[model samples]
Target: MPAPKKPASKKASVRKSTKPQPDQKVLIAKDSLSHSEHFKTFLGWVQDKMNENLIHLQTPQVIESTNRHFMVSGKIEAYDEIWDEWAKFVDN
Candidate 1:
């Protein structure tokens, strides 16, 4: 007589990859804009603004908002002009 096999787990087993992670700056550049409005839009926007190149892997958090847009620390001044540049960067 053969023994019965055990049932599979309800939760799938996830294997962690040992491969090196994709470049953070590249990842940011590859990201698309969520025109619905969110902080990620700002990250993608800044990456696009970095001389039309990706400059950061992990973007900063939103400090505040006005006129309904995300804002972060300025690169050369007290603050950079606030806008959802990513919205325009996205493929129409």
Candidate 2:
């Protein structure tokens, strides 16, 4: 009698590369000023105050501004203390 043959083992499949395709598009967000005169004036005043206090705060660039609100970004040390003073200034 003939002996039964064993089945061959299957090879493992290779994984596909995770790199992005050349045709893929990337999106980035940017900040821009709304060109409100009042906001610009307020930002200037803030800059002057920061300078006078010698707080080492970077110049704040306008991100977005409206008649009632504004957004700004800058580098600074002791941000919390400066922000508290700014809040008080805005309130009054």
Candidate 3:
């Protein structure tokens, strides 16, 4: 009862994310022959292409997959190229 209590601030600090954007693509398994298989195959193709592309690339690439999902880590452009060349491997 000596000093009056000060009001506590209820505002929480929200920080803007300054993290660099990830350079990879991710896919989740969701359906039939309209199918996740083709998408799975496509990610495999992307992984293969990225490995080939990485032969001269400064950054390394990594591929990870499971029955439920798939992900490839590296430069996003490599994923885009494989997207353009999914039917076959890139000559790299």
Candidate 4:
């Protein structure tokens, strides 16, 4: 048996609309937190937002959505190609 070869390059397929600007969010969070209780509340809010918007590798919903969109264009039929596109979408 032989080892599987890695992909040579990544492709773009589906994209996410929500991408948190870390610096901006942190600034806003800091501004809102004037006390310990407020800071904890703010931290919880941030964590919740991250979980809501961030894609989990083990989940299939996002990948399925991407594949559906890509099919409309008659391009990019594989899930592997969309990882970079998803990351870029989230980064923005």
Candidate 5:
């Protein structure tokens, strides 16, 4: 007769995650500027603000413009306090 197969070990049944995933949020901002230089300056300032607030920015800020309107979008990891501060910054 064939030998019986052994049962799987408890450790083998457990799953281990390789890396932890962070909560994420999408951020968007827009501005109306008549001067291209002002738009560039504003974009740099916003980027600095986000960094100072400890935001994990996923992508570089994207800026697009038409006529005299400008828009920017970025992706970042979500943390409540930081997100709130960022929102306030954008609003003002």
Candidate 6:
């Protein structure tokens, strides 16, 4: 086996900032709270302001309709043999 390599002794690094970073999200939240309080006072200072508020809410719905067709894609039998003629007559 080959001899193992020795590790480096000295390391280099950049200077760090002494001042703390400002939390913008926290500041924005505080501002929002003050603004909301002012808004509530203007809007009669009641919980029913939610009803007076003209906010649009959205909802999603999905609908699918399928005919009485046999999906014989994953079966062992042939596609034609999967659904009988009698079954087709009953479906109509």
Candidate 5 local lDDT, residue 79: 36
TM-score of each: 0.18, 0.27, 0.29, 0.27, 0.24, 0.19
Clashing residue pairs in candidate 4 (N, C-alpha, C atoms within 3 angstroms): none
Instruction: Residues 1-92, candidate 3: write the lDDT tens digits.
Output: 59988999899899989997644332221223124465667667777776765553432332223311223224547577656654332222
lDDT of 1 by residue, 1-92 (tens): 89999998798789999998889785566463433345456554654564321233133322234311222224312212333343444454
Best-first order by TM-score? 3, 4, 2, 5, 6, 1
Off by over 4 Å in 5: 1-35, 55-92
Evaluate all candidate structures by whole-model CA lDDT and list the values in order. 0.44, 0.43, 0.50, 0.48, 0.44, 0.37
List the candidate 2 regions with Cα displacement exceeding 4 Å: 1-33, 55-92
Q: Clashing residue pairs in candidate 3, if any?
A: 32-35
Q: Write the residue-wise lDDT of candidate 6 on 1-92 in tens digits.
A: 99999997887888999999869996666566455645444433232333322121111111121221222122213322323321232212
> Which run of 10 residues does model 6 get worst, by summed lDDT?
54-63
Name the TM-score of candidate 6: 0.19
Clashes of each: 0, 0, 1, 0, 0, 0
> Best by lDDT, which number?
3
Question: What is candidate 2's CA lDDT for residue 84?
Answer: 52
How should the candidates be ordered by lDDT, best one leading? Answer: 3, 4, 1, 5, 2, 6
Per-residue CA lDDT of model 5 for 1-92, tens digit only, reads 99999997776577889896543432223333323466556656655665744432332342123321222122223333444554443433
Model 3 accuracy (lDDT, Cα): 0.50
lDDT tens digits, residue span 1-92, model 2:
89999999999999998996543222111112223456456656656665644432222323134411222223233443555554442322
Q: For candidate 2, give the lDDT.
A: 0.43
Q: Tens digit of lDDT per residue, candidate 4, span 55-92?
A: 44225664568764444333322333343333332312
